[model samples]
Target: MSNKLSIVVVEPDRERAILIVDSLRAAGDFDVSVISEVTGLARHVSSRDPDVVLVDLTSPSRDILEELTLASGPLDRPVAMFVDRSDDSLTKAAIEAGVSAYVVDGLRADRIKPIMDAAIARFHMFHRMRLELETTKRALEERKVIDRAKGLLMKARGLDEEAAYALLRKTAMDQGRKVVDVAEALVTAAGLLS
Candidate 1:
């Protein structure tokens, strides 16, 4: 349980890579690993499971960006990419690809700490937004199921919406289950019968 940030650097340039590694180590308490080799870099980063990933490339190709995007998706951590030069389209693609921070021509040892901090913060904010979206989606799905079940009850038993909902609540309480669970069961059963 070390209170140190684990960092993985992917820089093809050996001199720049050393500088990046040195900067991170000097900035704060960090467990830093540098991958000079670009081949299978994403898999190596995944294996390390670093808290943050720093990619410094002179010029990144589309294939490299895609690989990085795949690495940062689903089981994503913070990713900071520093490029020598980039176009608007490339920058947009990087943001859409889940890059926490994309800095163009802003790779300096003195600036690494603050940039890394910003990247970590951005990552956390994105994570929070994703969680909120997932929670909202689940709630919406449950509501839809409950509404469908209520409609089915209304059609079958000539019950009003309130009565149908009450029945669901009562059934849930009696069965020691959630209203959503009961509603889901009813919906599933109705679907099967239909």
Candidate 2:
């Protein structure tokens, strides 16, 4: 467990996973751990919070892509893929899914060593700045969404500002979603139906 940096490899092949771990450890840059599935990776991300995620992907899955996209987007976590398949569509989807670096098959110590360092460093730098920006933007956006939803609630349901806010809060609580999420849904539905 290196305090400096960590990378979780999503390789299901026990042999390849071990090899990747050895190679990465040999690089002497990263503390590498392997997770066999997306669920394991999610838990690893939440608990370990690795500086960079190196997913050894053989194919694509929509749920994984969405999770990766959301994890990388507002959270600004950096994820890269050690991909076996080079299909154009898969590459495009991986990029879209927030995989920062898509390394092809030739993952030698010398070739991928520097890349691993650079990716981890850049991911930390960019992730920090992106997190700050996203926090500010989220706050501002939350206010706007809540205000819009409140306005709609007052106009359509004849409620005061406090009552409108309460309605939004109640909906969020009942649905087990964030207040901002509820507000956004209200705004979208209003736009569509009203």
TM-score of candidate 1 on Cα atoms, chains taken together: 0.48
Per-residue accuracy of model 1 over 81-150 as CA lDDT, tens digit each: 5433344554444354344333222344444445465434443454567689999999999999999989
Q: Which runs of model 2 end up more than 4 angstroms from their true locations?
A: 1-125
Cα error, candidate 1, residue 182 (Å): 0.6
Worst 10 residues of 1 by lDDT: 97-106
Q: Among these predicted structures, which one has the highest lDDT?
A: 1
Q: Write the per-residue lDDT of candidate 2 for residues 105-157, one digit (tens) a residue.
A: 23443444454554344335444676899999989989999999999999999
Candidate 2 residue-wise lDDT at 81: 48
Clashing pairs in 2: none
Clashing pairs in 1: none
Against the reference, the lDDT scores of all candidates come to: 0.64, 0.61
- What's the CA error at residue 171 for candidate 1, in Å? 0.9
